[model samples]
Target chain A: MPEPMGFFTDTTVCIGCKACEVACKEWNQLPAENGGIRELSGDSYDNTRRLDGIHWRHVRFIEQFKGPYDGRWLMMSDVCKHCVQAGCLEVCPTGAIIRTEFDTVVIQSDVCNGCRACIAACPFGVIDINPVSGTAQKCTLCYDRLKVGLEPACSKACPTDSIQFGSIVELRTRAQKRVDQLKSQGVKAELYGADPNGALGGLNSFYLLVDQPEVYGLPRNPQLPTRNLAKSSSFSLASAAVLGVLALVGLRKRRMDDMGGPGAGGSN
Target chain B: MSDTFFSGAPHWAWLIILYFFVGGIAGGACFLAAVVDWFGGPEDRPVVRTGYSVAAWGAILSGALLTIDLGRPLRFWHMLFQSANVPALMFKGWSPISFGAWAILVFGLFAVLSALGGMAEEGRLHNPALRAVGGAVRGGLAKVVGGVAGLLGVFIAGYTGILLSVTNRPIWADSPWLGALFVASGASTGAAALILLAPGRGATEQSLARLSAFDTKALVVELLVLVLFVASLGSVNRVWIGFWGLVLLVGVVGLGIVAPLRLHLQRRPLASAAKLVLLGGFLLRVATILASEGIERYRVAAGM
Candidate 1:
């Protein structure tokens, strides 16, 4: 629906401006949540720090040093990936978290029980509970704007077109061209979360990275928690089965004592 | 190399820890009682009564803890009956929390009924009608209810572990062994609860010995599960092994299992060890939840 809206965040051109963050807060009508005041993070201009309950769009500042003087500041504007198999959607008990018509994940505040299940389930750590609303909140990919045939506020406000919003298909074509162009220019450019075959079935909001994905604080291999369900469930069953055996041992020992045996269980 | 130490975990917080503790302990107690009622015979009524009462109370406590901790405390009905729900007996999806709620609620109800079945033995229900209520729940009915409650109790014990394992956090998702660890710990709590609340007042030396022996077995299970859980985490990160691991080792494994085993072997008063195990239970839950700090707490990372 709606041509599978998505965001192609080209961190290569990002200028570390707070415009995306500001636009997100302004458009979503989110309250000031960075310690309830305009306080600096002391970790450079990354004052908002992370994607959280309030701040959906975060500009990550990764200052890397190769030597005493050789260093580079890698700035990337990060947002929810809106994964195809979103862990948050999979774990939300109340079904409050749903993939939108545009294939972006959105949490329904009214239906959210605020058990914070999604908070942990989200591999991206994008979803958080609004303190005031008492519900899980995350980037909606500007669901309202998408409905009205407009772009997300963050992309609209991005001065350098670093954050582009449009059909995922179109964005992928553009992102691939950019990656190849940068690679030809000797930039060590790479694509992250772009493949539809990876664990998450790919991200609607993919990224174009200049360095390794891990260098940007992104997981080298992100996966849904459900992947371990079979293994984990099996372990639990094994545990319960062991406990059941112990319960048998307990009952048997008691029976022996009752029948006037030597009380073997008394020692062990 | 990543510069930040952000752990993308959950914000389960204190209330949830408390809920897990209560739910585990309660489920354990109920399960223990159900076991006794179904199979322990007439001589084991005291332990059965104690077990049922503890389970009933535990179920009630957990239910309250969860509801009050919820963001939308009033809309519990949404969890119980929505398009997603199948009414009171509803269970859909891998939402272990919702399933746990159903298990605890149902287990609590059965536990209460089972506990009431013990009322006739306490005397003073001379009002023929009231006595009949108690009498009806006795005998075959008690066995059926106890059997069901016991099974639910076991589920309750392991449900929290399953819930945590399903999350993407490595400390939690690292192993399925958490389920085993929880069930074992829960059963230990059940024995400990019975030892604390109803310490065999007219219990035969034989019956007391039996309970103690069974508790030792429960401790054995607990220690084994802990070992399995730790083994699964094997060399991930020492940050957790340093603090939460220490808590699991000392607070749970040492205090919970070793102390009780020693106390039981010496034929000494087990109240101290039982109390220690109870305390260890709460500490274990708290430490695990707090351990999520580096991963999912107030930190920043590249992406999920």
Candidate 2:
């Protein structure tokens, strides 16, 4: 009924303060820093142990450029893409997961039977089952907040406005402009998940990246599970048919043998 | 596992495991139905009737498992109710899975009717309507129902493997033969399960042996494909090599092929040996696929 809502993540401006993470926790009433105090993961300042059920919004800090000429820290807050052709949406059995009128993916916790289907179907590894609730939970893109006339908590709390929230069309335009602006500034920035025709039908929440998507733990080509369902089923059916024929032929031969070479039953 | 190697294993891997698990159960039920019908036991009529019913149930269960894995489970009906994009590898459509679902429903209904007919034949019910329904099911209709269910189950089982094989993941995509291998594995596993569950006899043992033989063949083929796939990678990362090699040996060679062979050769009872082999093979396939993902990730990280 309303204009479809989405996220436009401009990674170039991300300062990696992780305020988005805290904001998400506060708004969603999620636990802050799983496994007690946050310890350094030894990779970088990232100690949140990757995206899980509780931590919907993860601010990844990737340090690159070994010595002197290449010293830059890449910072980006990642969340569910809420894909148009969402694999998780396609695989849920209990109707627990739904695409809202906002066009964002959300799991109804009350309806979820802790089946973990959405967890497996998500290509981004974004959705997970909360160990405590036994139900799949992820970034609702602040569905509750959006219901009221307010922006998502993460976007509001973000000092740098790296995680921008808006309509899908506007976000794509903004993402492209941001990439162009970064390129003008001599930074080779690119937009990810903005191509509506791309794999997974592009994302409602897209990204701006300085490096390859794989570096940021993103699938280069995400696919749906139902794609090969037919071919696989055909193969299975063919095998069964062959088996059936063989069984039938074998049965007929045995029956003939039992009937005395098919002549004993004839009373000519 | 090394951080680099284990990094970003996709969620599809787990869903694939779930697919194989559910499909295996369905395929097994179908094979049981065939075995029961082929050999006339005191419970043969009931077994045959229930076998189709169980296969139908399995198909429905598998479908449910698949749906649960989706991000939007509510839109699952779109695959059935809407038009599908054909060329897209993940295009939701009237696929074998969907067909299998339909087949399961149809076959299940007929099988239930046939079972009711068997009960009627045994004088368990005096109602003429029930007898007339049973008589209809017993004459010509029963075979059609069994045929359709068996066909659908076969597809459901084989497709699980082909789905992975179609992926560009080197471990799976390279092997065109993997699909056939999966079908054989499904059939063998299904037959073995059915044989075990049915009353024990020498004939059942022989049937199980036949199923085991097919499994052995599939294992050999899978092993060969694994070797070729691994060798083609050509001096991959150490972690990738070790992990995949271990998987091939233990999962493919040990559990899928050798365990069943050992059980058969040792002259253990059909039910006992079939159960062990069936369970072992199912686990082996799932473990192999998961390990394959791990290996692929390792190689990717190593830039090989």
Candidate 3:
């Protein structure tokens, strides 16, 4: 009914403000993190443990130092990829995980049976089960907000507009242009989850990375669980067939052995 | 053992390995039932009936374990009611979960019918309608239902491998052979479990021996594939060499494929050795998956 919407996260411009996180919590009514305590993570300013049921939008702070230059703080607001080939969607048994008309992945919380298949299937460790609700929870890309003709809360609240939201096609074009701009400025910025042929058939919400994806806790190659299923099923069937034949032969042999015995024959 | 641990592996990798372990157990149970049912012997019917019941229950339980690990457990139904995403690798055009659910339902129904049939034949149930239902189930109708349910079971069992292989993760994605590996592992474990569970008798012993031989053959194939996969990783992905090497040498050879083979060859009782092998196989899968996760993490870290 509407254009396919998605997120274009430009990691280079992210300031790690985490306003998006606050906005998401406010809009979605998610609970406070660690009872809203101000504790340092020792790793960075990212006190939030990680993406879980309560926290949908996470700003990752990666501290890096290159050559003799002063160390730089890389911040990227991360959310669900809304992958074109979502593993979570495939493995979910209850039909709770669904793709919206906007081509974004969303889980129907009401219908979910608290099966963690999607959590296991997700390559990025983005999804989690809500301990409180006993249901799988992740960023819905603000499906509820989208339905009312408004942008996602996180995108709207981003101070630097790091988490951009718009049509996937338009976003891709904008992302490519941003990458080109970064390259012109001698920055080695590349797009992760951009190539459709790449792992997971690209993501509806892709990223602009200054370094490798793993530095941002992204998997280099995210496989689909179903691919392995087809191959294993065929082999299993063939093995079973072979076993079945052997069993039949064994049955025939047993029958013959019974017939050969003196007490085997009886009046019908 | 310290060297075997891959520091880069995340929590999800461990979770997947657990998933595979449970899935294999469930699938193997069903396979064992099928083999026993097809091959007649003393107590074969009882063995077959028990195997099916265990498998049915085991599958549901394993599925539950997987569901418990999800972030949106309440949204589990979206996999069935929502529009299927054909292009997505994980998209079950018709939810495999739904298929598995139906399979369990059918198998449970069949088990009840068969049990009622036994009761009717034994003069426990005198009602004519009950007898009729039992008779209908034992007739041609049972075969059709069993066939459909069996087919569904196989799919559910095999789908786990496909789910892993479709990812671009090099350690897993490199092998177009994972599916076969999963199937072989499932069957081997299934047969071994049945052997261990079935009552001891000369006929049952002989049946177990045959099943063991079949399992051995499947294990050999799995071993070969693991070797080939590790060897290929030497050139395909250098990091995988170390990670998968440990997995192959320790996890698969030492634990899964070989250790049980050794036990069986030593003339140990079927129950002990079969259980050992099944445990080993489950460990091997978990270790391999975790190793793959580590390698992937390393690749990402190194910007490869």
Tell me which of candidates 1 and 2 scores higher on lDDT: 1
Model 3 residue runs over 4 Å out of place are A37-39, A66-70, A84-87, A167-181, A192-203, A219-229, A238-268, B1-36, B39-91, B94-98, B115-136, B139-157, B163-179, B200-260, B263-268, B281-304
The model with the greatest DockQ is 1
Candidate 3 docking class = acceptable
Report each candidate's C-alpha RMSD, comma-separated, in the order given: 3.0, 7.3, 6.6
Model 1 residue B220 CA deviation (Å) reads: 2.3
Off by over 4 Å in 2: A33-39, A68-70, A252-268, B1-26, B35-149, B155-182, B194-240, B243-247, B258-276, B289-304
Superposed by TM-score, candidate 1 places the C-alpha of residue B222 at a distance from the truth, in angstroms, of 1.7
Residue by residue across A52-84, what tens digits does model 2's lDDT show? 788899887766768989688877798888999
Residue A164 shift from truth in candidate 3, angstroms: 3.3
Q: Would you list the clashing residue pairs of candidate 1?
A: A123-B304, A124-B304, A217-B302, B7-B294, B7-B295, B7-B296, B8-B295, B9-B296
DockQ, candidate 2, comes to 0.11
Ranking by lDDT: 1, 3, 2
- Higher-scoring candidate on TM-score, 1 or 2: 1
**TM-scores for the candidates:** 0.92, 0.72, 0.74
Write model 3 residue lDDT over A61-146, tens digit each, in one string.
Answer: 77787766878888888888999989778767666788999889998877676655566567776776666676778899998889
Model 1: per-residue Cα lDDT over B141-211, one tens digit each: 77898889888888888889888888777567766777777887788777787777775534445555666
lDDT accuracy of residue A24 in candidate 3: 91
Local distance difference test, per candidate?
0.77, 0.62, 0.65
Predicted structure with the largest TM-score when compared to the true one: 1
**Residue A60 in model 1: shift from native, Å?**
0.8
